[model samples]
Target: MSLFRKPQPITVIALRDAPDLVTSLRRALETATDAERPGLERALALTEDVAERPDAELRGRWVRRHLDAAGYEGPADSVNAIRVLRQAEPGLTLLQALTYARETAAAENTPL
Candidate 1:
């Protein structure tokens, strides 16, 4: 019934439970606005304080960080958050999944 084959999804293995701060910030800085550049630059300067950590070792901190980043203020529902993240997009690393979950939670006004 079709002339072309369906595309196959690419598989990715996540090596870390958290994002790399320097790499992520540098990537963002490449396209940052003038107003946003200062804050991102400050964060880059304080990477030691605001760096991503293993979620398993610091679940609360992980949840709080994501929630705060998403501008969500509510109870921390980390389990559901991680679950939703995983279910959201296959092959995404936890770092990206967690960010997606945070934005989703904030948009839906739901605690995650």
Candidate 2:
């Protein structure tokens, strides 16, 4: 037998059906088109990459990177990011949702 491991396709669910963070973030980033990929695209991509692999330290790094890229520069902004992302409004792609988030953030003095 060989020592090398095999590759498996990451299981993906519909955005609406995503049960948790891995699936949810995957669907969120999936909505990001090639050009539309914003500041934290790599973090989004990295988080998805590690979902199957599941290294806690590695996952935390990327998750933090994602939060940082969303302009969550300080503690207050980060808190707002959490609130914005958790809203879960229907039928909007992550990018669209992000736009709404940014709009809302403007009023709150934060940037999503």
| Top TM-score prediction, candidate number | 1
List model 1 lDDT by residue over 1-112, tens digit each.
4547564342333245124777788888999999999999887777745445333324344445655665556544455556543554345555555554454445446354
List of clashing residue pairs for candidate 1 = none
After superposition of all CA atoms, the RMSD between model 2 and the true structure is 18.5
lDDT of candidate 1 at residue 44, scale 0 to 100: 78
Best by lDDT: 1
Model 1, runs deviating above 4 Å: 1-19, 48-112
Poorest 10 consecutive residues by lDDT, candidate 1: 9-18
Collision count for each candidate, in order? 0, 0
Candidate 2: worst-modelled 10 consecutive residues by lDDT: 10-19
Candidate 2, residues 1-112: lDDT per residue as tens digits? Answer: 4456563332222132213655666566777777766734665666556555423333334334545566555432344654434342334444443443444344345343
At residue 8, candidate 1 shows an lDDT of 39
RMSD of each: 12.5, 18.5
lDDT of each: 0.55, 0.45
